[model samples]
Target: MQEFISYKNIQIAFTAEGKGKTIVLLHGFLESSSIWKHLTLELKKTHRVVTIDLLGHGNTEKLGYIHSMETMAEVVHAVLFHLKIKKFSLIGHSMGGYVALAFAEKFPQQLEKLILLNSSPVADSEERKQNRDRAKRLVKQNKKAFISMAIKNLFTDENRNALRPKINTLVEEATQIPEENIIAAIEGLKNRKDRTKVLQQYKGEKVIISGKNDPVVPFQEIKEIAEQAHSNFIAFEDGHMSYLENREELGEKLITLFS
Candidate 1:
Protein backbone atom coordinates (compact mmCIF):
# COMPACT_ATOMS: atom_id res chain seq x y z
CA MET A 1 0.00 0.00 0.00
CA GLN A 2 1.12 3.55 -0.69
CA GLU A 3 1.73 5.41 2.58
CA PHE A 4 3.05 8.64 4.01
CA ILE A 5 5.37 9.22 6.95
CA SER A 6 5.91 12.35 8.97
CA TYR A 7 9.53 13.38 8.72
CA LYS A 8 10.74 16.61 10.23
CA ASN A 9 7.08 17.58 10.42
CA ILE A 10 6.65 17.05 6.68
CA GLN A 11 5.05 14.10 4.93
CA ILE A 12 7.12 11.78 2.70
CA ALA A 13 5.51 9.29 0.32
CA PHE A 14 6.61 5.70 -0.30
CA THR A 15 5.25 2.30 -1.29
CA ALA A 16 6.26 -1.35 -1.00
CA GLU A 17 5.54 -4.30 -3.27
CA GLY A 18 6.57 -7.96 -3.70
CA LYS A 19 8.32 -9.90 -0.97
CA GLY A 20 11.72 -11.02 0.38
CA LYS A 21 14.82 -8.83 0.64
CA THR A 22 13.86 -5.16 0.27
CA ILE A 23 15.24 -2.99 -2.50
CA VAL A 24 14.69 0.74 -2.19
CA LEU A 25 14.40 2.80 -5.37
CA LEU A 26 14.92 6.57 -5.25
CA HIS A 27 14.20 8.72 -8.28
CA GLY A 28 16.29 11.56 -9.70
CA PHE A 29 15.58 15.28 -9.84
CA LEU A 30 12.10 16.21 -11.04
CA GLU A 31 11.13 12.56 -10.45
CA SER A 32 8.93 10.67 -8.06
CA SER A 33 8.59 7.04 -7.01
CA SER A 34 6.45 6.73 -10.13
CA ILE A 35 9.55 6.69 -12.32
CA TRP A 36 10.29 3.11 -11.16
CA LYS A 37 7.13 1.65 -12.73
CA HIS A 38 8.96 -0.33 -15.46
CA LEU A 39 11.99 -1.35 -13.44
CA THR A 40 9.96 -2.32 -10.37
CA LEU A 41 7.74 -4.60 -12.42
CA GLU A 42 10.79 -6.69 -13.30
CA LEU A 43 12.66 -6.35 -10.02
CA LYS A 44 9.75 -7.22 -7.73
CA LYS A 45 9.54 -10.65 -9.33
CA THR A 46 12.61 -11.56 -7.27
CA HIS A 47 12.70 -9.01 -4.49
CA ARG A 48 10.54 -6.69 -2.44
CA VAL A 49 10.83 -3.21 -3.88
CA VAL A 50 10.16 0.07 -2.15
CA THR A 51 9.85 3.33 -4.03
CA ILE A 52 10.21 6.65 -2.22
CA ASP A 53 9.34 10.17 -3.26
CA LEU A 54 12.05 12.31 -1.79
CA LEU A 55 11.35 15.50 0.13
CA GLY A 56 10.26 18.43 -2.07
CA HIS A 57 9.40 16.07 -4.93
CA GLY A 58 6.51 13.85 -5.94
CA ASN A 59 3.89 13.56 -3.18
CA THR A 60 6.37 14.47 -0.47
CA GLU A 61 6.39 17.84 1.25
CA LYS A 62 9.26 20.17 1.93
CA LEU A 63 10.44 20.62 5.52
CA GLY A 64 11.97 23.98 4.74
CA TYR A 65 13.53 26.04 1.99
CA ILE A 66 16.76 24.04 2.24
CA HIS A 67 16.39 20.35 1.52
CA SER A 68 20.00 19.34 2.01
CA MET A 69 21.15 15.88 0.97
CA GLU A 70 21.91 14.97 4.57
CA THR A 71 18.41 16.04 5.61
CA MET A 72 16.90 14.00 2.78
CA ALA A 73 19.00 11.02 3.86
CA GLU A 74 17.67 11.39 7.37
CA VAL A 75 14.17 11.36 5.98
CA VAL A 76 14.92 8.06 4.23
CA HIS A 77 16.38 6.65 7.40
CA ALA A 78 13.30 7.66 9.35
CA VAL A 79 10.94 6.01 6.88
CA LEU A 80 12.93 2.79 6.92
CA PHE A 81 13.20 2.93 10.65
CA HIS A 82 9.42 3.17 10.95
CA LEU A 83 9.06 0.19 8.62
CA LYS A 84 11.54 -1.83 10.65
CA ILE A 85 13.52 -2.38 7.48
CA LYS A 86 16.96 -2.58 9.05
CA LYS A 87 18.86 -3.77 6.01
CA PHE A 88 18.32 -3.44 2.28
CA SER A 89 19.88 -2.50 -1.02
CA LEU A 90 19.66 1.12 -2.21
CA ILE A 91 19.63 2.35 -5.78
CA GLY A 92 19.34 6.01 -6.74
CA HIS A 93 19.05 7.91 -10.00
CA SER A 94 20.83 11.22 -10.54
CA MET A 95 19.99 13.46 -7.57
CA GLY A 96 18.75 10.38 -5.77
CA GLY A 97 22.33 9.13 -5.85
CA TYR A 98 23.39 12.13 -3.82
CA VAL A 99 20.82 11.22 -1.17
CA ALA A 100 21.99 7.60 -1.25
CA LEU A 101 25.57 8.69 -0.63
CA ALA A 102 24.43 10.74 2.32
CA PHE A 103 22.54 7.72 3.64
CA ALA A 104 25.64 5.58 3.29
CA GLU A 105 27.71 8.04 5.25
CA LYS A 106 25.19 8.19 8.09
CA PHE A 107 24.40 4.48 8.27
CA PRO A 108 27.17 2.44 6.71
CA GLN A 109 25.95 -0.92 8.03
CA GLN A 110 22.40 -0.66 6.72
CA LEU A 111 23.11 -1.21 3.05
CA GLU A 112 23.70 -4.60 1.46
CA LYS A 113 24.51 -2.96 -1.84
CA LEU A 114 24.73 0.61 -3.09
CA ILE A 115 24.17 1.56 -6.69
CA LEU A 116 24.55 4.99 -8.31
CA LEU A 117 22.55 5.23 -11.54
CA ASN A 118 23.69 8.04 -13.80
CA SER A 119 25.07 9.76 -10.69
CA SER A 120 28.41 10.49 -9.00
CA PRO A 121 29.85 11.28 -5.58
CA VAL A 122 31.74 14.39 -6.56
CA ALA A 123 30.53 17.83 -5.54
CA ASP A 124 29.56 20.47 -8.06
CA SER A 125 32.39 22.52 -9.56
CA GLU A 126 32.25 26.30 -9.83
CA GLU A 127 30.89 26.15 -13.35
CA ARG A 128 28.10 23.70 -12.44
CA LYS A 129 27.15 25.82 -9.42
CA GLN A 130 26.83 28.82 -11.65
CA ASN A 131 24.69 26.79 -13.98
CA ARG A 132 22.49 25.77 -11.05
CA ASP A 133 21.98 29.43 -10.24
CA ARG A 134 20.89 29.94 -13.81
CA ALA A 135 18.55 26.97 -13.55
CA LYS A 136 16.91 28.45 -10.48
CA ARG A 137 16.49 31.72 -12.30
CA LEU A 138 14.99 29.95 -15.28
CA VAL A 139 12.61 28.11 -12.97
CA LYS A 140 11.39 31.36 -11.56
CA GLN A 141 11.06 32.93 -15.01
CA ASN A 142 9.34 30.03 -16.83
CA LYS A 143 9.01 26.78 -14.91
CA LYS A 144 7.02 24.96 -17.57
CA ALA A 145 9.25 25.94 -20.45
CA PHE A 146 12.45 25.18 -18.55
CA ILE A 147 11.20 21.74 -17.44
CA SER A 148 10.03 20.80 -20.94
CA MET A 149 13.34 21.70 -22.48
CA ALA A 150 15.36 20.06 -19.70
CA ILE A 151 13.53 16.75 -20.03
CA LYS A 152 13.97 16.71 -23.77
CA ASN A 153 17.69 17.39 -23.49
CA LEU A 154 18.15 14.50 -21.05
CA PHE A 155 18.06 11.94 -23.85
CA THR A 156 20.58 11.43 -26.65
CA ASP A 157 19.85 12.96 -30.04
CA GLU A 158 18.82 9.61 -31.50
CA ASN A 159 16.49 8.69 -28.65
CA ARG A 160 14.83 12.08 -28.43
CA ASN A 161 12.45 11.51 -31.34
CA ALA A 162 11.49 8.00 -30.35
CA LEU A 163 10.98 9.06 -26.71
CA ARG A 164 8.78 12.09 -27.34
CA PRO A 165 5.70 10.68 -25.60
CA LYS A 166 7.64 9.63 -22.53
CA ILE A 167 9.33 13.01 -22.46
CA ASN A 168 5.94 14.69 -22.30
CA THR A 169 4.92 12.53 -19.35
CA LEU A 170 8.13 13.42 -17.53
CA VAL A 171 7.66 17.10 -18.26
CA GLU A 172 4.14 16.95 -16.90
CA GLU A 173 5.41 15.48 -13.67
CA ALA A 174 8.21 18.01 -13.47
CA THR A 175 5.84 20.87 -14.04
CA GLN A 176 3.78 19.75 -11.06
CA ILE A 177 6.71 20.42 -8.77
CA PRO A 178 6.24 23.68 -6.90
CA GLU A 179 8.63 26.52 -7.69
CA GLU A 180 9.88 26.63 -4.10
CA ASN A 181 10.65 22.90 -3.92
CA ILE A 182 12.42 23.00 -7.24
CA ILE A 183 14.65 25.78 -6.06
CA ALA A 184 15.25 24.04 -2.73
CA ALA A 185 16.38 20.81 -4.34
CA ILE A 186 18.67 22.58 -6.78
CA GLU A 187 20.30 24.53 -4.01
CA GLY A 188 20.70 21.41 -1.87
CA LEU A 189 22.32 19.54 -4.74
CA LYS A 190 24.68 22.40 -5.45
CA ASN A 191 25.67 22.63 -1.80
CA ARG A 192 26.29 18.89 -1.44
CA LYS A 193 29.94 18.11 -0.72
CA ASP A 194 32.39 15.65 -2.21
CA ARG A 195 31.45 12.20 -0.96
CA THR A 196 33.99 10.15 -2.88
CA LYS A 197 35.62 9.13 0.36
CA VAL A 198 32.36 7.61 1.52
CA LEU A 199 32.48 5.29 -1.46
CA GLN A 200 36.17 4.59 -1.00
CA GLN A 201 35.65 3.46 2.59
CA TYR A 202 32.32 1.70 2.08
CA LYS A 203 32.35 -2.02 2.85
CA GLY A 204 29.26 -3.21 1.01
CA GLU A 205 29.25 -3.84 -2.73
CA LYS A 206 29.17 -0.59 -4.72
CA VAL A 207 28.14 -0.10 -8.32
CA ILE A 208 28.23 2.91 -10.62
CA ILE A 209 26.12 3.26 -13.76
CA SER A 210 26.96 6.15 -16.06
CA GLY A 211 25.81 7.58 -19.36
CA LYS A 212 28.62 8.38 -21.78
CA ASN A 213 26.82 11.44 -23.12
CA ASP A 214 25.23 12.52 -19.86
CA PRO A 215 25.01 16.30 -19.81
CA VAL A 216 25.24 16.50 -16.02
CA VAL A 217 27.66 13.71 -15.14
CA PRO A 218 30.97 13.05 -16.89
CA PHE A 219 31.75 9.48 -17.89
CA GLN A 220 35.45 9.84 -17.10
CA GLU A 221 34.69 11.05 -13.60
CA ILE A 222 32.34 8.11 -13.09
CA LYS A 223 35.07 5.75 -14.29
CA GLU A 224 37.48 7.26 -11.80
CA ILE A 225 34.94 6.85 -8.99
CA ALA A 226 34.51 3.20 -9.89
CA GLU A 227 38.25 2.68 -9.96
CA GLN A 228 38.74 4.38 -6.62
CA ALA A 229 35.86 2.63 -4.89
CA HIS A 230 36.87 -0.70 -6.45
CA SER A 231 33.31 -1.04 -7.64
CA ASN A 232 31.74 -2.45 -10.78
CA PHE A 233 30.91 0.24 -13.34
CA ILE A 234 28.69 0.28 -16.41
CA ALA A 235 28.74 2.96 -19.11
CA PHE A 236 26.23 3.41 -21.90
CA GLU A 237 26.54 5.40 -25.13
CA ASP A 238 23.28 7.15 -24.26
CA GLY A 239 22.79 10.40 -22.38
CA HIS A 240 21.60 11.16 -18.84
CA MET A 241 18.55 8.93 -19.05
CA SER A 242 20.25 5.58 -19.61
CA TYR A 243 17.43 3.87 -17.74
CA LEU A 244 15.10 4.93 -20.53
CA GLU A 245 17.65 4.75 -23.36
CA ASN A 246 18.68 1.16 -22.53
CA ARG A 247 16.02 -0.38 -20.32
CA GLU A 248 16.77 -3.98 -21.18
CA GLU A 249 20.51 -3.63 -20.60
CA LEU A 250 20.07 -1.55 -17.45
CA GLY A 251 17.42 -3.96 -16.13
CA GLU A 252 19.74 -6.92 -16.59
CA LYS A 253 22.53 -5.06 -14.84
CA LEU A 254 20.22 -4.23 -11.92
CA ILE A 255 19.13 -7.86 -11.61
CA THR A 256 22.75 -8.89 -11.36
CA LEU A 257 23.42 -6.06 -8.93
CA PHE A 258 20.68 -7.13 -6.49
CA SER A 259 21.61 -10.79 -6.67
Candidate 2:
Protein backbone atom coordinates (compact mmCIF):
# COMPACT_ATOMS: atom_id res chain seq x y z
CA MET A 1 0.00 0.00 0.00
CA GLN A 2 1.15 3.54 -0.70
CA GLU A 3 1.74 5.82 2.26
CA PHE A 4 2.96 9.29 3.12
CA ILE A 5 4.79 11.06 5.93
CA SER A 6 5.46 14.72 6.61
CA TYR A 7 9.06 15.80 6.23
CA LYS A 8 10.05 19.44 6.23
CA ASN A 9 6.36 20.27 5.87
CA ILE A 10 5.93 18.11 2.78
CA GLN A 11 4.31 14.71 2.25
CA ILE A 12 6.97 12.16 1.32
CA ALA A 13 5.66 9.11 -0.55
CA PHE A 14 6.80 5.51 -0.16
CA THR A 15 5.58 1.91 -0.13
CA ALA A 16 6.40 -1.24 1.81
CA GLU A 17 5.30 -4.60 0.44
CA GLY A 18 5.67 -8.36 1.02
CA LYS A 19 7.29 -9.83 4.13
CA GLY A 20 10.77 -10.79 5.32
CA LYS A 21 14.01 -8.85 5.56
CA THR A 22 13.78 -5.40 4.07
CA ILE A 23 15.34 -4.12 0.83
CA VAL A 24 14.91 -0.47 -0.11
CA LEU A 25 15.13 0.57 -3.74
CA LEU A 26 15.87 4.17 -4.79
CA HIS A 27 15.33 5.37 -8.34
CA GLY A 28 17.49 7.52 -10.61
CA PHE A 29 17.01 11.14 -11.64
CA LEU A 30 13.84 11.85 -13.65
CA GLU A 31 12.49 8.60 -12.16
CA SER A 32 10.12 7.85 -9.34
CA SER A 33 9.39 4.82 -7.16
CA SER A 34 7.35 3.59 -10.13
CA ILE A 35 10.54 2.88 -12.02
CA TRP A 36 11.09 -0.22 -9.88
CA LYS A 37 7.75 -1.85 -10.78
CA HIS A 38 9.41 -4.85 -12.43
CA LEU A 39 12.13 -5.33 -9.79
CA THR A 40 9.65 -4.90 -6.95
CA LEU A 41 7.30 -7.48 -8.45
CA GLU A 42 10.05 -10.09 -8.33
CA LEU A 43 11.91 -9.07 -5.15
CA LYS A 44 8.74 -8.68 -3.08
CA LYS A 45 8.14 -12.38 -3.56
CA THR A 46 11.07 -13.13 -1.25
CA HIS A 47 11.81 -9.97 0.65
CA ARG A 48 9.90 -7.01 2.05
CA VAL A 49 10.63 -4.44 -0.63
CA VAL A 50 10.39 -0.73 0.10
CA THR A 51 10.58 1.91 -2.59
CA ILE A 52 10.60 5.66 -1.97
CA ASP A 53 10.02 8.47 -4.42
CA LEU A 54 12.76 10.86 -3.43
CA LEU A 55 12.12 14.54 -2.93
CA GLY A 56 10.93 16.46 -6.03
CA HIS A 57 10.02 13.25 -7.87
CA GLY A 58 7.06 10.88 -8.09
CA ASN A 59 4.34 11.54 -5.52
CA THR A 60 6.69 13.26 -3.11
CA GLU A 61 6.86 17.02 -2.62
CA LYS A 62 9.91 19.05 -3.27
CA LEU A 63 11.81 20.37 -0.22
CA GLY A 64 13.36 23.52 -1.62
CA TYR A 65 15.32 25.23 -4.36
CA ILE A 66 18.57 23.23 -4.02
CA HIS A 67 17.96 19.61 -3.04
CA SER A 68 21.45 18.45 -2.25
CA MET A 69 22.18 14.72 -2.18
CA GLU A 70 22.80 14.98 1.55
CA THR A 71 19.41 16.58 2.03
CA MET A 72 17.79 13.85 -0.08
CA ALA A 73 19.53 11.21 2.07
CA GLU A 74 18.05 12.78 5.17
CA VAL A 75 14.62 12.45 3.64
CA VAL A 76 15.20 8.74 3.04
CA HIS A 77 16.53 8.33 6.56
CA ALA A 78 13.49 10.09 7.98
CA VAL A 79 11.04 7.91 6.03
CA LEU A 80 12.76 4.65 7.05
CA PHE A 81 12.96 5.88 10.62
CA HIS A 82 9.25 6.64 10.68
CA LEU A 83 8.55 3.15 9.38
CA LYS A 84 10.58 1.79 12.33
CA ILE A 85 12.96 0.12 9.91
CA LYS A 86 16.42 -0.05 11.46
CA LYS A 87 18.76 -1.94 9.16
CA PHE A 88 18.05 -2.85 5.56
CA SER A 89 19.81 -3.38 2.26
CA LEU A 90 19.83 -0.38 -0.09
CA ILE A 91 19.97 -0.36 -3.90
CA GLY A 92 20.33 2.94 -5.74
CA HIS A 93 20.41 3.59 -9.47
CA SER A 94 22.22 6.58 -11.00
CA MET A 95 21.22 9.69 -9.01
CA GLY A 96 19.70 7.38 -6.43
CA GLY A 97 23.15 5.91 -5.86
CA TYR A 98 24.43 9.36 -5.03
CA VAL A 99 21.80 9.65 -2.31
CA ALA A 100 22.67 6.14 -1.13
CA LEU A 101 26.29 7.10 -0.72
CA ALA A 102 25.35 10.17 1.26
CA PHE A 103 23.08 8.03 3.43
CA ALA A 104 25.82 5.46 3.96
CA GLU A 105 28.20 8.16 5.05
CA LYS A 106 25.88 9.55 7.72
CA PHE A 107 24.41 6.27 8.96
CA PRO A 108 26.95 3.58 8.21
CA GLN A 109 25.77 1.36 11.06
CA GLN A 110 22.23 1.22 9.70
CA LEU A 111 22.95 -0.56 6.42
CA GLU A 112 23.20 -4.29 5.75
CA LYS A 113 24.26 -4.08 2.13
CA LEU A 114 24.95 -1.18 -0.21
CA ILE A 115 24.53 -1.68 -3.95
CA LEU A 116 25.40 1.06 -6.43
CA LEU A 117 23.75 0.52 -9.81
CA ASN A 118 25.13 2.58 -12.69
CA SER A 119 26.40 5.01 -10.02
CA SER A 120 29.80 6.25 -8.97
CA PRO A 121 31.37 7.52 -5.77
CA VAL A 122 33.40 10.27 -7.32
CA ALA A 123 32.20 13.87 -7.47
CA ASP A 124 31.10 15.40 -10.74
CA SER A 125 33.99 16.17 -13.03
CA GLU A 126 34.62 19.70 -14.23
CA GLU A 127 33.07 18.87 -17.59
CA ARG A 128 30.10 17.20 -15.93
CA LYS A 129 29.50 20.25 -13.76
CA GLN A 130 29.50 22.45 -16.83
CA ASN A 131 27.08 20.09 -18.55
CA ARG A 132 24.79 20.26 -15.53
CA ASP A 133 24.77 24.04 -15.77
CA ARG A 134 23.73 23.77 -19.41
CA ALA A 135 21.10 21.19 -18.51
CA LYS A 136 19.62 23.44 -15.86
CA ARG A 137 19.35 26.26 -18.38
CA LEU A 138 17.73 23.94 -20.91
CA VAL A 139 15.26 22.71 -18.31
CA LYS A 140 14.26 26.28 -17.57
CA GLN A 141 13.88 27.10 -21.27
CA ASN A 142 12.24 23.93 -22.64
CA LYS A 143 11.51 21.15 -20.14
CA LYS A 144 10.07 18.68 -22.64
CA ALA A 145 12.98 18.97 -25.00
CA PHE A 146 15.47 18.51 -22.16
CA ILE A 147 13.66 15.41 -20.93
CA SER A 148 13.51 13.89 -24.42
CA MET A 149 17.18 14.45 -25.18
CA ALA A 150 18.32 13.30 -21.74
CA ILE A 151 16.40 9.99 -21.72
CA LYS A 152 17.49 8.99 -25.22
CA ASN A 153 21.18 9.46 -24.44
CA LEU A 154 20.94 7.01 -21.51
CA PHE A 155 20.57 4.00 -23.84
CA THR A 156 23.23 2.70 -26.18
CA ASP A 157 23.08 3.49 -29.91
CA GLU A 158 22.92 -0.18 -30.84
CA ASN A 159 19.72 -0.69 -28.81
CA ARG A 160 18.12 2.75 -29.23
CA ASN A 161 15.83 1.72 -32.10
CA ALA A 162 14.75 -1.48 -30.41
CA LEU A 163 14.11 0.34 -27.13
CA ARG A 164 12.29 3.30 -28.67
CA PRO A 165 8.97 2.32 -27.10
CA LYS A 166 10.43 2.05 -23.62
CA ILE A 167 12.31 5.29 -24.17
CA ASN A 168 9.11 7.06 -25.14
CA THR A 169 7.38 5.89 -21.97
CA LEU A 170 10.26 7.18 -19.88
CA VAL A 171 10.24 10.51 -21.64
CA GLU A 172 6.54 10.86 -20.97
CA GLU A 173 6.95 10.10 -17.29
CA ALA A 174 9.97 12.38 -16.87
CA THR A 175 8.19 15.22 -18.60
CA GLN A 176 5.77 15.38 -15.66
CA ILE A 177 8.44 16.39 -13.17
CA PRO A 178 8.12 20.08 -12.29
CA GLU A 179 10.66 22.42 -13.85
CA GLU A 180 12.04 23.46 -10.45
CA ASN A 181 12.30 19.85 -9.30
CA ILE A 182 14.34 18.92 -12.36
CA ILE A 183 16.72 21.75 -11.71
CA ALA A 184 16.96 20.85 -8.03
CA ALA A 185 18.07 17.35 -8.96
CA ILE A 186 20.59 18.68 -11.44
CA GLU A 187 21.97 21.00 -8.78
CA GLY A 188 22.24 18.14 -6.29
CA LEU A 189 24.00 15.84 -8.75
CA LYS A 190 26.41 18.52 -9.84
CA ASN A 191 27.35 19.40 -6.27
CA ARG A 192 27.40 15.91 -4.76
CA LYS A 193 30.49 15.03 -2.76
CA ASP A 194 33.18 12.48 -3.56
CA ARG A 195 32.32 9.49 -1.42
CA THR A 196 34.97 7.12 -2.76
CA LYS A 197 36.58 6.72 0.65
CA VAL A 198 33.16 6.30 2.20
CA LEU A 199 32.51 3.28 -0.02
CA GLN A 200 36.02 1.94 0.45
CA GLN A 201 35.75 2.28 4.21
CA TYR A 202 32.35 0.66 4.47
CA LYS A 203 32.77 -2.66 6.28
CA GLY A 204 29.50 -4.26 5.28
CA GLU A 205 28.73 -6.17 2.10
CA LYS A 206 28.91 -3.82 -0.89
CA VAL A 207 28.78 -4.21 -4.64
CA ILE A 208 28.95 -2.09 -7.77
CA ILE A 209 26.73 -3.08 -10.72
CA SER A 210 27.61 -1.37 -13.97
CA GLY A 211 26.90 -1.55 -17.68
CA LYS A 212 29.82 -2.22 -19.99
CA ASN A 213 28.57 0.42 -22.39
CA ASP A 214 27.13 2.81 -19.82
CA PRO A 215 27.40 6.30 -21.28
CA VAL A 216 26.81 7.94 -17.91
CA VAL A 217 29.14 6.04 -15.63
CA PRO A 218 32.21 4.76 -17.47
CA PHE A 219 32.47 0.95 -17.16
CA GLN A 220 36.25 0.59 -16.80
CA GLU A 221 36.41 3.42 -14.27
CA ILE A 222 33.75 1.79 -12.09
CA LYS A 223 35.38 -1.64 -12.37
CA GLU A 224 38.67 -0.22 -11.21
CA ILE A 225 36.97 1.65 -8.37
CA ALA A 226 35.23 -1.57 -7.29
CA GLU A 227 38.54 -3.36 -7.27
CA GLN A 228 40.18 -0.60 -5.27
CA ALA A 229 37.37 -0.70 -2.75
CA HIS A 230 37.49 -4.51 -2.60
CA SER A 231 33.83 -4.61 -3.54
CA ASN A 232 32.24 -7.10 -5.91
CA PHE A 233 31.77 -5.94 -9.50
CA ILE A 234 28.98 -7.12 -11.79
CA ALA A 235 28.85 -6.04 -15.42
CA PHE A 236 26.06 -6.11 -17.99
CA GLU A 237 26.46 -5.94 -21.77
CA ASP A 238 24.20 -2.93 -22.13
CA GLY A 239 23.99 0.78 -21.38
CA HIS A 240 22.93 2.76 -18.32
CA MET A 241 19.30 1.64 -18.39
CA SER A 242 20.14 -2.01 -17.70
CA TYR A 243 16.83 -2.49 -15.90
CA LEU A 244 15.13 -2.21 -19.31
CA GLU A 245 17.84 -3.66 -21.56
CA ASN A 246 19.00 -6.49 -19.27
CA ARG A 247 16.02 -6.89 -17.00
CA GLU A 248 16.34 -10.62 -16.39
CA GLU A 249 20.05 -10.49 -15.70
CA LEU A 250 19.59 -7.62 -13.24
CA GLY A 251 16.79 -9.42 -11.42
CA GLU A 252 18.84 -12.60 -11.14
CA LYS A 253 21.89 -10.75 -9.91
CA LEU A 254 19.88 -8.84 -7.31
CA ILE A 255 18.18 -12.05 -6.13
CA THR A 256 21.49 -13.88 -5.80
CA LEU A 257 23.06 -11.04 -3.87
CA PHE A 258 20.18 -10.45 -1.48
CA SER A 259 19.33 -14.11 -1.08
- Top of the candidates by lDDT: 2
lDDT of 2 by residue, 30-89 (tens): 999988999999999999999999999999998888889999999999988998999999
Q: Write down the RMSD of all candidates, one decimal each.
A: 1.0, 0.8
For candidate 2, list the clashing residue pairs, or say none: none
**Reference-based lDDT, each prediction:** 0.91, 0.93
Question: Model 2 — TM-score against the truth?
Answer: 0.98
- Poorest lDDT segment (10 consecutive residues) of candidate 2: 158-167
| Candidate 1 Cα outliers beyond 4 Å, as residue runs | none
lDDT of 1 by residue, 198-219 (tens): 9899999898999999988988
Model 1, TM vs. native: 0.98
Task: Kindly report which residue stretches of model 2 are placed more than 4 angstroms away from their true locations once superposed.
Answer: none
User: Judged by TM-score, which candidate is best?
Assistant: 2
